[model samples]
Target: MKIILILVLFNLQSGSEVITAEFDDARACDLAALRTFQGVTAEPDMRPLDPAEGASAIEGTVIAHDSDGAEIGMYSCNPSRSDRREG
Candidate 1:
């Protein structure tokens, strides 16, 4: 039982590898594909980008996973519509 518990802990600690691909001018449809790929059902978490803090003109979304692991979600960003200027 101790060995089994150790193996389980090791598996949870060693996260799976993730491959990323960037798409230029990506559409809303692209997000659907990502949802399918990750098997995520809950609505993604969205955060606004503030240019005053030296952040780019982009908004970020957190797509969560249904499984228990070190990584809870995938973070993606899209262009922000805020008119705030950036340095």
Candidate 2:
């Protein structure tokens, strides 16, 4: 199954932004998230979203910190199946 990483950035003042990337599997998606977190000094907090019928997803919140170690913004990454074509 293919996995797509959906990233949503939530900013209180401005708004929210979404970014997506496709991967071959969930492991690759999760690794990409981890690598992204490493770049911005973020704290990773992961939780599983409620599954819908036959679908399952894992969502994680990344808290970004400024250079002085202050909270800047937060974003979530959810990995799920990307192939939606019916068999």
Candidate 3:
């Protein structure tokens, strides 16, 4: 039981990642370039769209890291285009 508990705790304290939306054209381009971070830059997998699509959105992943590099949380980044407009 002790070993099982330890394993469970270890799994709970791990770093994780998430897919998010980023509409920043410039930032999107930078991420798309994948040149600045030695290929660590994640690319946005555009969601499929249809004629009925209301707005265009880009999907990006967010990597959440724990203190010791242990994935603790994972989530998506849906960065609204407001920041881009401000810049």
Name the top lDDT candidate. Answer: 2
lDDT per residue for candidate 2 within 57-84, as digits (tens), equals 4455455555565544444444454456
Superposed Cα deviation of residue 27, candidate 2 (Å):
0.6
Candidate 2 regions off by >4 Å?
49-87
The sequence of per-residue lDDT tens digits that candidate 3 reaches over residues 1-87 is 000000011133354333233334545533432332223323322222232357633344333334345433222334343434532
Error of 2 at 32 (Å): 1.4
As a TM-score, model 1 comes out at 0.33
lDDT of 1 at 13: 52
- lDDT, candidates in the order shown: 0.37, 0.58, 0.31
Backbone clash tally (model 1): 0
The model with the greatest TM-score is 2
- Where model 3 places Cα greater than 4 Å from the true spot, the runs are 1-58, 79-87
**What TM-score goes with each of the models?**
0.33, 0.49, 0.24
| Candidate 3 TM-score over all chains jointly | 0.24
